[model samples]
Target: MAGYLTTHVLDTARGCPAAGLKIMLYKLSGNSHRKLLEVVTNDDGRTNAPILPAESFETGSYELVFCAGDYLRATGQAGDDPLFLDEIPIRFGMSDAEAHYHVPLLLSPFSYGTYRGS
Candidate 1:
């Protein structure tokens, strides 16, 4: 079995998908981080392809940075300074290289949450 990674973003405030949101994937190593990929959410609040394809999947610690504040501001929901939730970073580990990892974010201007999904 081959492993892969995926993600999804939802705008809970507007009750719709978070389109055009920017996402960055980074591989972490000993207090150092290397960016792997950058992607934007589609109309369905998902990337057009997997965040980490099976060919590049590896067992390690990874971080996902989501530009939620910019997204909300772009959608006319947030203003400058003192923004509630800005960039959200999710750090997780891949223990099983053969299992699928789905990180889904349910977000609003003031709050957000994420979990491992199927």
Candidate 2:
């Protein structure tokens, strides 16, 4: 089977899926960052489809930028001025081209965490 990439976000503070959050995918090489695509989370806190599909799967460095501040503000969880957690960027390396990569974000207004999920 071929590989692909998928992601999701959960509002830990609200204990629910983070719907409507914007996410950006980027391909990185050296000091250059190339945008792959932009997508919004659905009601299930997941993209409608794999962000990185099997046909385009690659083994390299990639980044996912979650627009947490916007989501926080929309949910009335953001504070005044600057947010402690704004655009959360998670950089990771995919070494296996034939593996399914699931990255999930556990987020709150003040903090966040991520892990390689199934």
Which numbered prediction scores highest in TM-score against the true structure?
A: 2
Off by over 4 Å in 1: none
The sequence of per-residue lDDT tens digits that candidate 2 reaches over residues 51-74 is: 999999999999999999999999
- Superposing all C-alpha atoms, what RMSD in Å does each candidate have to the true structure? 0.8, 0.5
- Candidate 1 per-residue lDDT, tens place, 1-118, comes to 7999999999999999999999999999999999999999999999999999999999999999999989999999997678988999999999998999999999998889999999
Least lDDT summed over 10 consecutive residues: which range in candidate 1?
77-86
Candidate 1: residue 69 lDDT (0-100): 88
Q: Pairs clashing in candidate 2?
A: none
State residue 29's C-alpha deviation in candidate 2, in Å: 0.4
Q: What is the C-alpha lDDT of each candidate?
A: 0.95, 0.97
